[model samples]
Target: MHVENSLTHYCIPCDETVCCACVSSRHAQHQTADLVEYIKQKKIDISKHKIQIAAEHLPQLTKELEVLKQAKEVYQISADKVTSKAQERAELMKQVIDLVLDSQLSEIQKVKDRDLDTFIFRENEICFQIEDMKKIVADENGGENAESESDFNIISAEREMKQKLESFSISERSRPLPPKFIQGIDDMIPEISRLLGKVERVGEIDGGVTQRKSAAEVKVQIMNTVSCAKPGHKVTSICQTSSNDVIVAYNTQKSIDFIDRNGRKLKAKKLQFETQDITMNKKGDLFLTVNDSSLIYKMKTPGNPTQLYNGGPYKALGLCAQKNGNLAAALWKQEEGIIAIINSGGKLTETISYDRTGNKLFKKPYRICENSNGDLIVTDSALKTVTGVDPRRHRRFQYNGGTEAKNFIPIGVACDSSARIIVSNWKGNSVHLLTSDGEFFRFILSSRENVTYPHALSIDSLHRLWIAQKEKVVIVKYLK
Candidate 1:
């Protein structure tokens, strides 16, 4: 019985409440010498009772620790949420205060403006009434002496009122222009002041904000035809002058005529050239390009054309004012080919030579114009294509519609007011409309009848498409 008791289970390290047979056989040669020495040295080791106690209370300790950890996490999360909410509240309050202050400031400004308007109106009225009194005094100076004195007094009062009104011009009541009154300057002052006070009172808030407002719908009216035109002559180009008169470049049976918009031909004493293309600069001057001539003629006013360059035979196709205030000309010759550049002191400024595929710039450059992006658009009739070149002369619009002339013989080209390219096809006997990016969009032709040949095209401010039929010798206007 004693030997069997010694073989029962016991923790050997504690060295307590184990029979000699258990301690001597199992724990005698253990690998942990410190545990074995502790077991041997302790007077009261808990080896026998440790397992029993841990088995009884481990589940409760585990549950209590889990509860403590969960509580700690919940508390931290709640604190963070409260901080965020407080910040949001603070921001909202700040915005509200600012809006209120701004609205109040706007109202105050409106009130001040109204007061100023009223004061000006009253002052003007008083001045006019005093003027009437002065007129009465002037008319009745030979009456009774007392009445004369009274009229003089009235005149003095009127003069004083007139002086005061003159000090404040009636133009003050006119519209206050632009950003100065965009937010009702007076109304914003109070709102901004309020925001200055309530900045931190509001809690955590996102600084990003959104505002939406409706804008006024502006109505614009346009006229399709020239409002008032000359009765008999064919007007090639019309330029409106700063003096409210249109300088018209017109053509009669014999010579090109210059006239005002009212049809009265201006006395152009110096301009004695028959020109095909005419233009006007902003300074109300004339620029005419004669057929088969290299020089561009400049008429500083309504007078005879003066040759810009006498070294002729270099046929300048088109002339336009560049952004740099220098004149740009497209000059073409068989040897020189086609080149466009700014003319500074009769010298070329920039030159571009090749297409994207390293081909020559133009076979026979006919006309050139500037597009919306300030690019020079040139029409090469021999190549049967239109090309857009940058200021640096790099080819941008290499519009190659095959080598076939029937599909792409662009003769007359003009840009409409909406930036749509209108090109008259010499071979096709039709017109092609191209988008600003040089993409072919649509065809403009009278489907009812095939016109013989469309020569030149132009677009007026009203977006009307005008085609000059050389064979017909008549200019026809078409709907857009």
Candidate 2:
């Protein structure tokens, strides 16, 4: 008996071989293509995939694997050195009890084992991924199935393999293994000696672990004041541009002056209305609010200003930019004020007018800032408090100068890189540092600094605090 041609055609949907009769009988409505033609296109696709894997994906993964291997080696070397040092110290203390020595050695060994296990597990994981990727490249090059595999089978395999390779590419972007082991035995040296009975009491690690500098550790010293603008111009707001140039907005003049680090006026832009508040966005564009209208204008340069927000009934008093490319405007209507978050196209995305309890949130919101954690920090001038609102416009907490912050009257608000909210006191002539959640941290600048009329506050890229006074700009180095 003669066998029919069963693999004359390919069913694209079912991904299988089919004869002429089967194509018409079962897969008549399905997409069918010539087996030879399908195989030809699949071969081309497989060739391109192989090139991507070899030229791009494999090389990157191989580099990452090498890095992981080197890290593992370093970890092993450090473990060996720690173990050897413990042994030498134990040998020197010949009169020490065997039980105490063993305990000390056991502690060292525990650290070594734990770190090595983590390093090895990470190393093996990278190695396995590398090998799997290599296998994919090899399979795409038709490892052993080149001769007999059907076209449908080849196409299906290539699709699945490409997905896995793409997934590997994505995983490489966020690989979690640290470049080197950071934990060390330096903290355990004294403890090890005391545990060996060399002293009557047990010793603790001098510094258990490395810690970040807290807000309390930060100290501020007034560097110097520079006359940024003209004599009669009152500094209304101050911000640092992306080019590290300080820009000061003046109330008396319809202009904003850009000053360099050495306090030289580099450029100035004349505005139509007196500048009320000015802030720099991440793109280095300036957003300014005028005293006359409710609109906010975005100025890429001095003369060319485009209206950003012109909708709400309240007049814009202060302007600030969020990290997500949204602008926060302190809008005031008579005695009540609201923090409105506007998009780039001058549309309001959210408004912070009321708290979760349906109570009004702000009395007179001015000088708005967004913290690193997405909380809006507003200086409520009327209430004499600084309030933090969540992304959902709910009140997180409020700072009313507490007992130490007498006569607070917060005016300009800014959050530093360390997530500390710095609020300038209008009447107290000092600046208060609060935690991001509005808890009172400490006074960064006290009234003792001889600061008079501290109004607008800003934190520069170097973590230096900039205070806008009457006609001068004060720069203070508050963080190292």
Candidate 3:
């Protein structure tokens, strides 16, 4: 639609197909080329542009083709690898099939050999019994009214063997034997039956016969662990201090010793008398509950102590600190069974007792922690259950030593801020985790070299388990 003006000399420079007559006349000398020649030059320029565009596209097309070729080669390599692996597996399967067939044939041959042994044994035993009977009959013919005691013993032994065969037959009749196995055993049955019939025809006689059943023996392989030195005392209680040092109380020595993380002994003075269970309170105070003693001792500082709880006819097995400034203890009473609760200043705040279903807090209980909106996860060693009691005094979760539960005897209980309950079972010698609802998570297997006889457990701020054991203490970080 463009037209060249008079000032412009070339139509191409003006980008026009035609120019006005005055423009053509004024530029006649500047552009004297013919119109047909101009058209030819324009066509040449168009061809050059087309060639440039094609050259630009060629590299891109080449790059795309190279990429496709690489992808195809990679796929072919992976396919070849997979096919080779499948062929190897098929060859291994064939070898295993051949081995199985050989094993089966060998088992069949063993059965045949055992059947032949059984037939021979039965025939020899029958012949021996017949010969003994004939000897007794010959002795009677020699004018002996009473047979010798040896003859009577032989008869008694034969009778016992016959009775054993009869019992075996009776026991075997209820179930149908495999036809192949029964066919292998058929040859000995006739001779065995004939011997039994002969023994039955001998009639009843009095003889002192001793029937002995082979005792069943169970082989238990007990590998005795020899780790610690032979201390002059037994470990009465174990506790961990704030500095991660384990304190083991010995009853005979009447002392507590500092133990390293590797269960190596350290020099520490013993606290006096039968230390049964030891625990540490929030103020880093060491507390010891003496067995069969009414008083509990608290060490404000190391080697300096004072009696905290006196005037009590109870024995404490476990002690823990509540979130508040109170002490929770598992106490055994003469009249009542073991009860776990927090006794603040000799006043019971929260008491837990069991019913028929082993539910704790079934009765009305008060001050069960308003901040903690979940159940009171308590491990009962006597009842072998971990009971969960809601704040409203309702039994919400219960896991016991039933066929379904994993724990055997739960002794200690500790809960995290996230309401994950950790329980240590004395029988299992391992720690178990339970959700807030008492469902099992998994067991923490005891590291034999470091941890053994785990009796108590607590979770730290970082969710790592601080376990209390007999010989040493262990800390395990739980992974999310």
Candidate 4:
């Protein structure tokens, strides 16, 4: 019974050693190898697997378990610390709230007690008056000699009763009941809870994850200086027409001069009264504010100026045309001024004297302009700030040029086609660019050689900024 005859062949599919007779019978279709060779290959594979489990798999799994245990400990410690801190803060807040609640309750109770005592005292005084009247009536009802005594006593009692009644009437009519206590905790508790939740969320967030936005950058440089008005005539205000023509208002000359882009005089009109400010309407007609007068004049080319609107009590100073065919005028009533919005039909539409919060919007409005969004931009000379008013006649925002505009004294304001507000600060000797909402965007021009006292500002159809200074007008091409 040799081993080769007994179980020599190893059937790979059945994983069993078989004899030659078994291979011929049940294992005929199976792949078979010699038993000794199969055992030797399996031994080598098992040895390699054992080395991998001992050297790599087991050691790696043990290291991972140790790391997980350490992480669990760290997490537990952190959670405990956070919980302790939150509890401490909550306890402190509760103590503070309790103290405030107790103090408020004590004050309210004192008020209630005082009021109740006053009411009780008043009731006792009323009862005492009733008893005195009853005694006077009883004495008057007695017989014979009581008649004469009662007559004298009745007159005196009647006089005293009338005085008491008058005092009681006053008290009954004038005395007010105590105010009822209102619990505001119902409204405040939700807000406080929301704030606490926000605090917790903020604590969880990393401070390094926040990103900041960069400020808008703008560069402005002067293009050239051009004499747009007559020599020795002061330019009070400036505006641009649709055809790129600039209209300059001369207060001393009482005239408006239309000049081309190159400072060549194209057309000139002599106004009856001295003009303070000039603006152009949609039809290219000029609206001029008569200085020290409550009248605004509308002038067309080759036609005499006609009275556009009567400002009545307000004296028109600076004027601008709105997109809706209305006129916004900076009018001075007395010491304080207002921005008046008048319709094209010479009717006063609205007046902005005070803000929605009932605060004075302007002390002395010098220049006025309407933005593309129907907002009125005005430079308040007395306040030294540029103020914006919305179409609904509410004060939007005010800009005093912050620290960047040193010694700011805004005198003129204009809005460009891009909705950017241009303000000229005469005292500061600088021109500032602001957003439509009256935020200071940048400094467009600063006084230097040849540029002093920038008084008026206007942006033309070509986006060129025309600055009216004393004696000379500086034109700058500002790229937003």
Candidate 5:
């Protein structure tokens, strides 16, 4: 309605620029200021902000962009490498198939060569018999006037010739039937497809950090501390998002909570039942394992969680994210336990029950984590030991705490960029470091240093460790 009129004044009450017509209309009672002055002030503010951006934000963003580009380059190189490997496997399979094909063709040639040998022999024999018969009729000698009337000898010769013919005859089944090639390519497609192997998209590396301090040179110090649990809520699990926000799961209260970096509270998602373990996927969806139900649930950010899987009678006791963007869920039933490997689509791809020598791998898997080297780190709370399994499904080592830590209760497990495993010793009230090969390195933190009963552990991109102990979640930076 005011498109035809030019704005000249700013209405203070309405907080909008007004034309001459607006002055006598709804904006007549409101205080007004010169639009030209307001425009000047806005320009001044924009210029000031532009200077701040150039001095502060632009340089930081440029560096961040460079880091992001490097990450992209790394990802592409890794993908190309895997693709070449898969192609090599396919080429090898093709060569093997060609060998099989040549084998069948060679067999057919063998049959042909064998049948031709018998046929040639029979042909020569029949020719000789025909020559003998010709002699019976005449020409026993070179001249045409030999003995030409011998009936008894002719009858006896004919009987003997029939017996010779019978020796060269072949049985019907013994005769070759030309081998036909039927469809054999797609018979084991499901199995043959697996031979090429899957292209696993490993989990992302936040901020592209790939370095860590050695055990001997590490300095442990508290970086930041946050508390998400209420007075009586028990913190069962704690994990970090890509943005470094904390997500805590409560088993006693049957709820999941979130908190941002600035200590501001985010929207908390409730749960229908208590969960023992919780994990976040690459897609930012949170997964939790209910203690009583066999169902595993996935929760979208700022939304409710729904059922993502059912593990039959073996309820999931622990959940963790795999480096291949898959999920590692530990389930227990009937005093036996197994770790189920699930893909991103919520389908169970494989299950690990026994090691290479057919020995039981675990009886109770409490908490699980996947290392950067594709090894699985699982804590068996029942046995009070940690099992390290390699990618080949071989149990590499079982780490029962050292002599000093007799009653070790390993609760949460995590790994740094160098594959150094950090375990929270709940009973010993310390955090222990283990080499990538599962050998004991040293204790990084202990209750003597004010770290009491470390329950869950998480290492972030900045090399900060978030340890959940009691009602407080403490962030520790052990890497120098």
Candidate 6:
């Protein structure tokens, strides 16, 4: 409780003022003094504190202020330099704009003149025809010479009319469309990309850069690239013999080319049979599948290809030699998909049609390969899936990419010695690796590595990858 006593005392030990009633209660044990005398002593202490502050702290604060001003002046100089550089850039940009304008204007004037000349010529020709026809009509309509015209004049006039009619032609050139103003940033990405290059901060400190997940990384080396430069030829399928020689199949050109790992062209031949797939068997003989059930084979010599077997009425697309020396072919029977296994003696042994759940294995299976473990790997283009089949002709696993698979249209399938499968994603523009059990493991190739629109895939005996691009093939050395 506070007292309203006008008289107060200074409790020196507590450094507080107290009323008479309070000095006798809460501060009864503290030493006390007169309030007026304590005020006079405090005023003296304040004077001494001001003198200390002016001597020590004030000079230090002034020095700090001067340092701040100097640092700000340095920043101001740099700012001035930046402003000057920007002005210079602006002047250069204006000059370039003027040059571009002049070039575009000249092209426009040329097109305009050409179009106007053609239009004027056509108009004058039509005008002359109209005037000649009108004069003949006027003369025939009794313009003072209708009754007096002789037979020679009439015959000559008729011949002239026939000549004009026969020679009349309104030749039309392909219409020239008005030029459209194309927006260019330059392809800002293209020709002049190096001109006004990117401006970025120098000596940027790296902060928490992202690393690709180890699970999503698989290293592969590109050994060589074999370019298929034959005009009108497109790569369809690829196969490698046990000796690491590559055979590239092309459809439009009706050709199969042979090349080594060094990209040297060994030989090429235009095949007599329409080839849907090509592969070499255990005897180093080539097996060629036509669009139908006909299978053609040839010895190492490029002689006349012999039709090995013709299974009736089925469309065959892709086939591969199995570990057991049998040939497994993807056949279309009655608009359905079947993998037919042919014995070494060129007779149909078994056909796999459905999975364990009675689900159709494939809608349209095109490319096929057999793993070292006798698991037949097939790429179903219509279903966009890569399926694995065991030696028993039973469906083992089917993969269409996982949840992370984007636009996953699988095109090519290859198996290595480890039974690992590689599938090329056409729409995704990437190549993916799969575990032996048909699970998506990681991406081994992508568009960033120039693996765009990849189609055919094959693995040689050395476990190297031969990937076919649009017009070229690359032999890549696979890593773990």
Q: Which candidate wins on TM-score?
A: 2
Q: What lDDT tens digits, residue by residue, belong to model 4 across residues 271-374?
A: 78788888888888888888888899988865888998877687889988886688888888767898777788776656678876789999889998888666
Q: Estimate each model's TM-score.
A: 0.44, 0.55, 0.43, 0.53, 0.54, 0.53
- Which residue ranges in model 6 land beyond 4 Å of their true spot? 1-218, 291-302, 403-406
Give the worst 10-residue stretch by lDDT in candidate 5.
207-216
**Predicted candidate 3 versus true structure: per-residue lDDT over 353-403, tens digit per residue:** 654466443221111111133355556655567767664446677777333
| Residue lDDT tens for model 6, 76-143 | 79768777876777678779979999999899889888988877887888899888778867866865
> How displaced is residue 68 in candidate 1, in Å?
60
Using TM-score as the measure, name the better of candidate 2 and candidate 3: 2
Can you give the lDDT of residue 17 in candidate 1?
A: 43
Ranking by TM-score: 2, 5, 4, 6, 1, 3
Q: What is the Cα-based TM-score of model 6?
A: 0.53
Q: Tell me, by lDDT, which candidate is best.
A: 5
Model 5, residue 228: displacement in angstroms?
A: 1.9
TM-score of 3: 0.43
Error of 1 at 319 (Å): 2.3
Backbone Cα, N, C clashes tallied per candidate: 20, 0, 2, 0, 0, 2
Candidate 4 residues lying further than 4 Å off, grouped into runs, are: 1-219, 229-232, 404-406
Q: Residue-wise lDDT of candidate 1 within 117-203, one digit each (tens)?
A: 877777787688678767766755745455335778889967986786575444644634322334667787776556444323222
Arranged by lDDT with the best first, the candidates are 5, 2, 4, 6, 1, 3
lDDT of 2 at 9: 89
Badly placed stretches (over 4 Å) of model 2 are 1-219, 404-406
| Clashes, model 5 | 0
Q: What is every candidate's alpha-carbon RMSD to the true fold?
A: 41.5, 38.8, 34.2, 34.5, 22.5, 34.1
